[model samples]
Target: MMQRCFSLLFGMLAWSAAIALEAPAESHPGARAFAAELARDPLAIEQGLSEAAILATLDQARYQQTIIDAISRPAESKAWKDYRPIFLTDKRINDGVAFYRAHADLLQRLEKEFGVPASIIVTIIGVETSYGRITGKYRVLDALTTLAFYYPARAPFFQGELKQLFLLHGTRFPYATTELMGSYAGAMGWGQFMPSSIAKFARDEDSDGKIDLWNSISDICASVANYFTAHGWQTGGPVAVRANVDKNARVITPGSLEPVYPLTQLEEWGYHLGSNPGGAKPDGQTPVTLLQLEGAEGTEFWIVFQNFYVISRYNRSPLYSMAVLQLSEAITRELSKPAQ
Candidate 1:
């Protein structure tokens, strides 16, 4: 009886080992790698996130093929003619005016405090999320995890953002990492700021003791203004102006979007001031750059000033900066006119 009992115990032990071997792996290799990296940080371990828990979170992240496809075709890739109408529509302009009027007191206070224009602030929010109506729906964790591990194009950047998300949740944010939602790139809230941007620029404008950008208009507007001011947005400065190019003018394409030349040098290069001009020509020393955009009628030219460069700092695309500038101008014009 004793021999038989020992034999049954050994068989049960062997079966348990076999079942363990047959079980599927719980974590992906990419997730394991990220988990290992995260475990190396003492703070992450201190935050009560065990390696197993981190791996579980990563395992739940679904790789989004749609996000991969969308990342390849950003609006910034479109030509100015194709891009302008996307953001500068009558609806967007009208909505921006309404949003401005609705939040005029807060906006005026932001403009006074930050030295940034209220119209520009409204235009940024309008262009980013359609006046806070269409903030993205994708889970930020899945987006950042997929992009950080699977998408190789900007993996390092996304990885840093993923780390920032962890740090943000660990430090001040009260929600779970999986609970936050944003763009395919993980840009969150009305301003569509990345996790790193939130960590650095998000503010509790309402003094509610927590930064609630997702629902707080005051926080959203103030955060947007803070980001712009932090990026060196000039107060009461010209953004851009239309320019008349000589029919036979040489097309001087700048290698970068940065303001590399002065207005005097651009005039020497055959770009003359054109219709609906903004500020007067500055002294020969003020830096400016010539911008060429494809219009429906023909090629369009513009002289972009320092403020234009500042706007580009928010989004490195000239088209995006132009769209925001034009939209802001439209809203300002509509607001200036008498209400019918």
Candidate 2:
């Protein structure tokens, strides 16, 4: 009886071992990719494409090569820091002057039509691609797909961008080859448009029925103006100003796109604007926000109005907005000078 019990126990142990061996592995590459795609859009993506095609696209995509290449280092990176000095140099400033001089009429026209400053527009072009010199080398589609499929932290957002990209391609291209190239985040053109923004805001200024952001300067300029206009750019208002902050002032909230405070409130805070700050709004005390930025020496203070806030909408970062503002100011100052 004892020997029979031992045999039964031994048989049960073997069966349990077999069951454990038969279980599926935890890491499923196919499932993970599908999950990433679905998380971006469960309904929008798996609609028409076959599972095989989807899987093949993910598999054939060069995810490994693209992810490592596309991810830009933070401003702490040597490239960004090194790149900053080049932009802030005298030669670039002189070049900015020359650029403005060459395109004075067009810049003025856009400013008049869009209520955005010509200097601001020129600066954006200068900083983005050195006035249309180096846009980017990576194909936008490849970048988006690689990041979406492989970069786990922000995969879903990139996947949504990929979806928008595909949709835009379908809407824009029926017969021609659909290919896009831009930054790692899939921002195309001198303006760096994400896929959704391209669909929503990209314009056909050339009247060619196609918006070629890659090569058309006219389209890029017009699109930038349109974007700013859509975001509430006041026709003729101050963008930013050097300010004297009172020692006693307690708090200063950043301004939003809307005019939040009256001009009276700003003056009361011991802030005053420089003469010819673009076009000042009526002196009815429109509320303004005081912003302080890091400078080489002491902190730089500026009292920004509604218009200044509008520029920030394009890029939420204060540093980016300030860069745009400073570069624009530099361009205008250089242009205003008599050629030496």
Candidate 3:
């Protein structure tokens, strides 16, 4: 008990010292270095933004200590048993079904054009922003700048995103950089797209010549579908199946969700199919990855395929991917019911 109390006190002290050490965003050395890099960056040159323009924008990016606190303890850090319920709630599932019904025509078009399932697309939006009802409360500039200059863990990644923000502002986005809002990690829109994702994957689906993810459902949905299509989302492909593991099943620790083994090979190694969620037979040669999630029942095993991997590209957590798959499954089943 004494040791635990000491640890807690030490943690609080360390946190306080860290916060105290951080200079204001405007005067931070990291912020100045970031501005220096953006001034000479080729993308900034292409955008025709001068050094003054970049500084003018950077000057508005006030660091929020809360963003650092939020990113430090991400929802993905939770166990599968804990994380699943956050997204796969009864309300989220029901809302997904209703959202599907309301946007059936547009969702259908997205699925048809991109070869991605409408249910999957709907689940993405539901999980990301609760169907746009809670897009985020932080400004994109603040979030990105805070993480880029203040958060050292992912400083390089966020710095790149900070640079991309300018490119997006000058080209794809019609709004000012200061007007954009997103998650603490600087992902924008209903889908929570990072600046890089918006640059590469966002679509102008409504033909408005501006991809408005906030108000335009067509653009938001299509942009998500296009991301899937680009990442090799196979039409009619299997997502995941529960695994029946034997006592002799190899204790495999996969480095990533990338499918490296086939079902037949897994079966040879004492893992076989259990609940086939998609009801589609995967070819014995299909590459798959084994996942062990701490489900409500206990430690549950699953054999996930390329389609599952594709979903992981959006956010690398297998737990997140599983929640999305399960939520989409629930929404799909609900949508399939006959209207009373």
Candidate 4:
């Protein structure tokens, strides 16, 4: 999976080169090529997805100017100090507790079955879509198609998702390709799964033979839990905690969220858990991430473990992962309170 990054980068470079060389002589250059590729794909042939339908769907794809603008300025672009307050507010935390309480049995059952905490699942829903309150307004077909064919920086990635969007009809998934709605990035449901994610992780929790991310609460909860479980969510393990930096030690920036180094190794690089480190502590040999963030007070450093990295896999932003962790912990605390 590490090679996926390199492959994506190489694809971006290729797209950029092509765009620089010539003007697009046709509309949806990316979609046209993508359709051609899909027509030849063996899976597409086997799935009974008609090439004609694929072309028709691509024809219906409208390039949304707003989606382009939105992707340019994601919340993850904001500083951690500014970003934390958006999802970490009292209202969000309180709502998460209420959501958890309303579906305690199902969420807890999923937690027990999947080894992912119910609070974390609830927090993901809260973070991704405000518990299904704002899944998105743009049609998923338009968003994916627009980004697939129009956005050159990551055209290949979006195009692949667009392919998966068409293939969703062939799978056990319930939504029609054109009728689907999601984020500007084409992610759907309470968890905002992209087409590929839906294909791989979406679950029919109620056992109704269809996976519906938008309407079924059980499906939403189970699908989110399945995603976390598949991504290696560690049950009852450390997510992250504050660490004090040795003033004289050299700065250490991790290459990626994949926990590549041990806590003992980071200690030599001048980072270690402060005296007040919270959560269940991992052993010194645990592979960890040395995270640096700009906080309200000053620079913040944290030691994050595999579970923390798993959170990052949900949303690649370190800030997003931290917010999910904080919100999950906050919900757990709120639940522990004695009812007034």
Which one wins on lDDT? Answer: 3
- Least accurate 10 contiguous residues by lDDT in model 4: 20-29
Error of 3 at 329 (Å): 0.5
lDDT of each: 0.84, 0.66, 0.88, 0.85
For residue 312, give model 1's deviation from the true position in Å. 1.9
Query: Please, what are the lDDT tens digits per residue for candidate 2 over residues 1-340?
Result: 9999999999999998765433221122533455355435644454454444444444434433544554745342333334356567676677777777787877788788887887777787777677777777776656776676557788778878866765564444322213566766667788777877877877787778778776776778877888888887777667777876678865676544345767677777676664557564457566567776666655667777777787777766556666777777777777777777
Weakest lDDT window of 10 consecutive positions for candidate 3: 19-28
Query: Which residue pairs overlap in candidate 2's backbone?
Result: 140-181, 261-286, 261-287, 262-285, 262-286, 262-287, 263-285, 263-286, 264-285
Per-candidate RMSD vs. true structure? 8.6, 10.1, 6.0, 10.3
TM-score of each: 0.87, 0.74, 0.91, 0.89
Task: Note the clash tally of each candidate.
Answer: 0, 9, 0, 0
What local lDDT score does residue 101 receive in model 1, on the 0 to 100 scale?
A: 99
lDDT of 1 by residue, 237-340 (tens): 77788888777776788876677897788888888767544555566766788888898788888888888988887788999999998899899999999989
Runs with alpha carbons beyond 4 Å of true place in candidate 3: 1-24, 277-280
lDDT for model 2, please. 0.66
Candidate 2 stretches greater than 4 Å from native: 1-56, 64-72, 76-86, 149-156, 170-178, 252-259, 274-276, 280-285
lDDT of 4 at 187: 93
Best by TM-score: 3
